[model samples]
Target: MTDALNDDRKGWMSLLAKAPPARLAALMPDLPDHALLRAPEVGAVMVRGRTGATGAPFNLGEMTVTRCSVRLAEGAVGHAWVQGRDKAHALRAAVVDALMQTPESAGLHACVLAPLAAEAELARAVRAGKAAATKVDFFTMVRGEDA
Candidate 1:
């Protein structure tokens, strides 16, 4: 892939990274259908920062990130995690893993990550536009009065 497209894909991945497992589950039902020879188990939790517009840094509360690994019936191993209590994320991550081990990475990326990314982008754009429209400019003008 070209650098621009790669960057776009990264953006898509980032959206998927932040996505809640439940949301993803609604979008991709097949994620949870795979028979898990292995199942997801919590591995780690870490505190992360919340960034503001213009990349300003802000400290947000710690988030719990669970990681798990699973093996499908076809002998493909996958790993994934969800923020908070999201089992769906772990399941989907495993499915993606199994797909990646096969020749289905492109399909998974397109069907799952791409649409999620597009939706996220649309939501962000809408929010930005709304905020911009509501912006209020304040100014003070001085006039020559009795002196």
Candidate 2:
């Protein structure tokens, strides 16, 4: 289990934290047919800002966030998310949500969530690499008078 955690660069909670609802739904399998799990609803987007590694402050833009809470017939609750207009992601998030409150979360995190987190990290890394390639540096020199 720890191996899986180390292998995945992105945290499992992070993968679920700002995911697209549709993608999440697609990834997450449905609970037992006899047992129904509630799906999460698309809620308000929360915005936050922070300084980059260089200590320059910037607005990080908004994330479309949805929250879902569900109770399995067996009484387990799971919740999850994706990014942007995504019902599938929301559904899957709810499944994860329901599983989280149970002892089964360890197994679920290892099997289901870890892979998703790893994939997300890979995608993020690719995007970061691409963005980094385009970074521009500007330099200015000050002129000095006679000493």
Error of 2 at 28 (Å): 2.7
> What tens-digit string does per-residue lDDT give for candidate 1 at 1-147?
499856754554445557766777776776534566546555445555646655766655566665666776666666565565566676676676566556667887788877777787788999999999999998857656832
Report every candidate's CA lDDT.
Answer: 0.66, 0.62
For model 1 the local lDDT of residue 10 reads 53
Q: What does the lDDT read for residue 91 in candidate 2?
A: 59
Q: Compute the lDDT of residue 119 as modeled in candidate 1.
A: 82
lDDT per residue for candidate 2 within 1-147, as digits (tens), equals 376744442355567766544555555656543233445566556565557656765767777766555567777655555556566565566666666656777887787677777777788999999999999887756646632
Clashes of each: 0, 25
- Top candidate when judged by TM-score against the true structure: 1
Per-model TM values vs. the true structure:
0.64, 0.57
For model 1, what is the C-alpha lDDT against the true structure?
0.66
TM-score of 1: 0.64
Instruction: Mark the 10 consecutive residues where model 1 has the least summed lDDT.
Output: 8-17
